[model samples]
Target chain A: MSAPHSATSANGVPTLDVARLREDFPILGQQINGRPLVYLDNAATSQKPVAVIDAIARYYREDNSNVHRGVHALSERATAAYEAARETVRGFLNAASSKEIIFTRGTTEAINLVAQAWGRSTLQPGDEVLITHMEHHSNIVPWQMVCEQTGATLRVAPINERGEVIMDEFERLLGERTKLVAVGHVSNALGTINPVARMIELAHAHEALALVDGAQATPHMVVDVQALGADFYALSGHKMFGPTGIGVLYGREALLDAMPPWQGGGDMIKAVSFEGTLYSDLPYKFEAGTPHIAGGVGLGAAVDYLAGVGREAIAAYEAELLAYTEARLQEVDGLRLIGTAENKAAVASFVLEGVHAHDLGTIVDHHGVAIRAGHHCAMPVMEFFGVAATSRASLAFYNTREEIDALVTALQDAQRIFG
Target chain B: MDLRDLYQDIIVDHNRSPRNFRRIDNATRMAQGYNPLCGDKLVIYITLKDGAISDVSFQGEGCAISTASASLMTEVLKGKTEAEAEALFDNMHRLLTEDAHGVDVDELGKLAALEGVRAYPTRVKCATLCWHTLQAALEEVDEPVTTE
Candidate 1:
């Protein structure tokens, strides 16, 4: 978790000392199937660094208590750490104020919050919610539910063969009725980095609010919600090497102030009178019940860990590694890489001609190479590609070229066995 | 565990060229099976003659294990009595779930080829989907069975 001691490669892009950095993650050192584990499933959920793990343990050991109610010392300490975790998350997204950052279960809950709270209040009958085809199920389903409840039509923008959003179609879908435009900053299944800044601007131009699903974006790239001019942004901590069951939702303060609380619980209420209940202010208003305090603390530690590694440096290193992986994957005959987007991030999804992805998954696991092989919760993306499933090797900053080579070897073994 | 144990030559051969990989157009009973985890789908068809299965075949798309499982199940279940197929289904289920101490592997015959799936817990559903579908068809369960 110390500063990234990664030496810069030629041409001045900072290349991480992945060898040394890998040492920080204990899980990476272990072996699977008698061979060293080659984890290429970062897009599924990243392996947590020791710092995040230690943070969770330390919270439970020292500051474990309910937040915001008790006057006891443990309560004060726990509340401080939990709120400080909120500030760290605010800084992670570069939001203007911590008040805009609401802690949720994960991106799915974050999206659902906006869909129910904002969509229910604002969406009128015949209003539209526009989204892209490459969105994860998390982003798509909430909007569909809201649309169904409010009698608003759900519109989908198509993506090209390369998995890039068809901007023209996206623009065409945007009109007077478009109430909310939700899109993923990066496609989880394809790793296509959408032009979200422009998309947000277009949504604003159409008088519609835009929300960016940053679950797949925060791990690999630096995100500034203000710079993107997004109305709402959502991110998952687990996908960024933090603990599971915790995430952040960053809404513009004005929008959050106007939207009603999504859930009612102990923390979210300021006063519960016999006559009526007065809701708490921004952030806490939407966070119902006791928050995931330990999760938040671990997420804070994960943010610190990423900062020390440097997001720009991690991006450059992983980009180089992704290129290496794509090229090496092409070495296997009958292997067809899906999602050949011009602008891509940490994922490489593909299908072998003769082998079903499920069979291929089993084949590679024997070699200690763990890659995700399924719909990736993006069934529409699978449908678009005309595949039942795909074998995806989603890289991380810690993954090595050697690991990718091992993956290729294992893939060849699959071909040999099935050939 | 060695990959060969799971992807044995027989399993691979059956996957490459599956037996009974056809639809019985005159089928008397049919049932669908789905494994949502891997998106494996298998449809089992059985034509009964005198309350006994006279013709059997399968049609569907799934992973190697599921495809080979369906192919093998159809081949073995042809002309089997309804009760006989049900007993075999129970045996196949036990073979996949039990440890070495529990089930008799020698009696399983070609179904023994699937015992390796015990090592890969996630793949057990793949090997069982066909058997479940065949069981459903025998009972004439109209709804599709899912290996959740």
Candidate 2:
């Protein structure tokens, strides 16, 4: 496959015009602590572009109504916009059909939907649900809940010191009894890109379904659910420069058709009565009630904006930024970078000598550099690394080398104060 | 908020070398506290003699603020009755959470070092993790305390 036009540079290196891209996000222009804001917490939630924000506001102002309920003009318009958003997300993940895409609150909700709907029905008492040590809490906790409810066992696939998944161990754990394999496409805490495609193949070999938590991966790369052949793929819209409270769950149509509805409410029902109620068809069977209409619209706009920028270009630019960030961070003495994986995204988690992540986070905030300081909702990874917390600077395409320099300077300031 | 105010010398000093930083044997009461946000875990133990806290200690891993707060709490808790310790906890809670303008710094003594925690809303939980565990220990609650 050829690189997108915006991704290719003269020297065969993929590059993005980050300066022009920065103009799209107005929040990046604001000042924090009397300095220009340097947002590097994209893993937490990305700053939305004007197009997405405007799309949401436009929906609320121009077409605010309950979707799929009323036959009126406003409701029809809102329903059209909401359904269009699903089509946009379907294209974003390159799913085979819109029927496979289910709108959810976020990745957490999407995972819960799958766990409760599919896991509860499918898992037996002795069944095992395999997950990695590097998965975010969203992926871990939902399966835990399912296991607790269904009397199934939860197995953990270990990661090496460099934070990459030990695939041999992963395959060893995937036995005939293993019912599901839930893994993150990218580690939010360590930025370790797991070998999920091969892992999925291994799961399929063992007759276990694979669910990819694509929250961290969707923003940084081009994800084709059909190409990956994943049983289920989840994404959070907010992490991909869309509004909060909206996400997508792409499941195989066959799997989705077999799984019962997760929630029973307004839109998920076909014909309801006191005696019985038939569930709706695929996608709607999972998305219950009047959904986050504006959020869906905003996510659709975000998809358009990302496509305009080109996902390949964004991924390439972020890869360069990650390298630049890692090199710059190394210049700071006594700094230890965590998660030294061969394959990584634009996340840099580190700890400075004699400085707590919390202290570093505070000091850096004063310098107007936003970083995530804590376990990054991956405590198992922290325990594995033998640290309480690590300060993380996660990047987006809008971030520049200068912002990384600012982050390094802030770390130096932290060293000066705590040294 | 000034960073110096939060990471005052006393707090930093106590963090470097915490007092009563050990696991107590034959404790009258004990409890575990966990702050899931930052992964701060601490176990608080107290020995009571004739209705007074004869000795107190803690062991765990946490950030500087949490470690120092735990250390300071252990120091002040010794030689105080359960009622007095509870009152002191209330005072510390107010001092750490509320405005320091009207609070008597002299009464707070070394604990005033943690007064800057109120400025960082997120860190307030870190500073108080041990105190909550201490409360749990005093009440003899078997379940672990968590700052969720």
Give the residue spans of candidate 2 off by over 4 A: A1-7, B50-52, B146-148
Q: What lDDT does each candidate get? A: 0.92, 0.91
| lDDT tens digits, residue span A358-404, model 2 | 88888899999999999898989999999989999999999999999
Locate the minimum summed-lDDT window of 10 residues in model 2 chain A.
A1-10
Model 1, position A40, has a per-residue lDDT of 94
Clashing pairs in 1: none
What is the DockQ of the complex in model 1? 0.84
> What tens digits encode model 1's per-residue C-alpha lDDT throughout A297-349?
99999999998888999998889889999999888888898999999999999
lDDT score of residue A380 within candidate 2: 94
Residue A49 error for model 2, in Å? 0.3
TM-score, candidate number 1 = 0.98
Residue B130, model 2: Cα distance from true site in angstroms: 3.0
Model 1 error, position B97 (Å):
0.9
Q: For candidate 1, what is the DockQ-based docking class?
A: high
